[model samples]
Target: MIAKGTPFVASYSGGKDSTLALWRAVRAGGKPLALLTMLDETGGRSRSHGILPAVLDAQAAALGLPRISGQASWGDYERVFVEQLGRARAMGAVAAVFGDIDLAAHRQWEEQVCAQASLAPVLPLWGEDRLALVREFVDAGFAARIVVIRRDLMADDYLGRVLDHALIERMLADGIDPCGEAGEFHTLVTGGPLFAKPLALADGDVRADGDYLSLDFGLAASI
Candidate 1:
């Protein structure tokens, strides 16, 4: 049986890592109380990859999770992010889950924030083998698509492609991190083992802005 009253918040980015992390948390007998995402108010983008907020909401709904989001400018990231987390804490969340792998600076920042909020930081995929983890995500029935690609490291052709074993193999063969930890690519989870339903998105044009190539998906009719 899962632990009762152990409210936990999953830091969701609509990415494979966050999807896998939340799945692991659920499997570990923790109650997922909420999902948290940071929205960029200035550019109407997700902080990490510039995905549309509407798409993120659709993904959250598919996961059957309530989301608590905050909009902030680039300069206000740390403050607004922490404030949103504190709100989650006030709602009785005891811990926060992250899907980070082998990023010391990220881990340190997460620890600091959790400490401030008095919430335990859980890194479910930390220090795991990147290639193995990618394989696991695909094999475990998660449906992820490359929504953003860094132009210098990866071509724009990868945008909007499903992240499967074939994609993982190709990435590995190219000496790129299978998980795209080095900003080679970013993904959005449309369907996954943890989702109660699949997100319905209308395909939009891919736009290139400076160093990033982003695929836009707008909300169609919800399924």
Candidate 2:
């Protein structure tokens, strides 16, 4: 468990795993100082999920946390992330929390970067059973929707669908990972126990990038 009452920076991706990690951290009495996100080179969308800045802001607002985002290309991602972590450290953050479940290389990088920034690395979901983790998130009342999927692995119809038992069963029947850990899919969480209110989203255009088909999502003006 994280040291209670200690301020920590969350490696937020606006996805189910990160959301669950944040939720767990809060429940364990960790104080979230900021939500750190990596943006594309233009700083318009997230690096992995393609969520807009406004959309991420809404998510941060819902969770009542500050959003700290940085823009960088693939070549400079590590440097940019470490720079942000340094800023967070200066802001009194002693640890960095991540949502990675079982990626050894990813965890190593997270630890290395945190060490460089003078912060300890914390991974709440490390080594947990993937399928059980999905059930835990859903049962804990966290709501999320699919936002991207591998075109070769799933149909476009899978996009924008809620992550729930039915979807889990379907994915299982289709022989796909429930958590989509193998790059099978990605999701955007809209509501959950950690949120003060739900985010309003609208479906935008669908575009194909590499092996993935992404469903662009826009935030509603009400936010």
Candidate 3:
């Protein structure tokens, strides 16, 4: 566990895992230096969840934290990620938080990149029961919606569904990991104890790309 009040950077993806990770870090008394997200070379969409920059900014605003993003291609992803880690370090971040659960390859990569950047890699959700983590996230008042799903593993009906106990049970009944750890799904967190305000999402058409379906959501007009 990170020392209380230690400055940390969150490896944010504007998704459920990152949201839960950040929330736990704050609750554990870490000072959040920034939310760092990786973007595609065009800086149009997040590499993982296809979330737009504007929506990410809105999330940062609600969290009262700065959003730091870098554009990178597949070939230079690690280099760009290390650079972001260095930037966060320069901002007084002593460690960086990750949300990977039981993925040895992911953990190895994070540790390697953090070592290169001289930042300690912290994984709060590592090695825990997936179902328990999902339950904790929802039960703790974090509100999230399914924003991406594997077409081969999930149906269109799951797109944009709010994450809750019932939803997790349904996914489990379908023989999927409740936490979506195996690339079965991705999510967009809209509200929770960590946010100062809830995001009003303007739903967009669902689009399919190869084996994945993505939800195109934008910030709705605030009344």
> Model 1: residues >4 Å from true position, as ranges?
1-5
Model with the higher TM-score, candidate 1 or 2: 2
RMSD after CA superposition, every candidate: 2.3, 1.2, 1.3
Query: Which of the two candidates, 1 or 3, achieves a greater lDDT against the reference?
Result: 3
Over 1-223, each residue of candidate 1 has an lDDT whose tens digit, in order, gives 2254467898888899988988888887888888999988764778887788778878878788888888988788878888888988988898999999899999999999889888899998999899888899999999888888888898667789999988877877777787888888889888979778877787787788888988888877631
Which of candidates 1 and 3 reaches a greater TM-score? 3
Residues 41-75, model 2: lDDT tens digits: 99989998988888899999999999998899999
TM-scores of the candidates are: 0.94, 0.97, 0.98
Separate clash counts for every candidate: 0, 0, 0
What is the lDDT for 121 in model 2?
95
Candidate 1 vs. true structure, TM-score? 0.94
Residue lDDT tens for model 3, 104-203: 9999999999999999999988998889999999998989999999989998899999999899989988999988888999999999988999998989
Model 2 / residue 51 / CA error / Å: 0.7
lDDT of 1: 0.85
